[model samples]
Target: EKTETNILKGIERMRRFAERFALAAAYPIAMEIIEALQRAAPVDKIEPAGSLRRMRDTIGDLDILVTSKKAE
Candidate 1:
């Protein structure tokens, strides 16, 4: 019970931190990031995942999926 209570408290603190500091970025900004990645890396497949891929108006954090033929 004590461990569970501590876990719950930790979760609550993290939730508060996210609410205060994790503002969503605009779709255009996220797309720009994706474009930059494509230019910077020799990626076979590069795209945005998560909320950004779903075309959400705002994304909490940019989730990128990249695949490369050469491992360097």
Candidate 2:
């Protein structure tokens, strides 16, 4: 039982670490995507939302808002 408990705890810790790493890794990619979108579209304003906006250590997904004169 003790061994099982230890293994479970280790797994949980690893999962949390992976989540944080993934988020950290995604920041650059998200920024690139946002930049590309701005360049491709006629955007006046672009802002990060959700976890990225909050500047959290870990993010599950990216949310962005864009405003453009071309948008209807």
Query: In candidate 1, what are the lDDT values of residues 1-72, reduced to their tens digit?
Result: 999999999999777556332225456676688788889988898877886777664456677888999899
TM-score for each model: 0.57, 0.68
- Candidate 1 runs further than 4 Å off: 1-25
User: How close is each model in CA RMSD to the real structure?
Assistant: 6.8, 2.9
- The candidate that achieves the highest lDDT relative to the unseen native structure: 2
Candidate models: Cα lDDT each: 0.73, 0.84
Q: Model 2 Cα displacement at 22 (Å)? A: 3.6
Among the numbered candidates, top TM-score falls to 2
Q: Which residue pairs of candidate 1 clash?
A: none
Model 2 spans with C-alpha error above 4 angstroms: 1-21
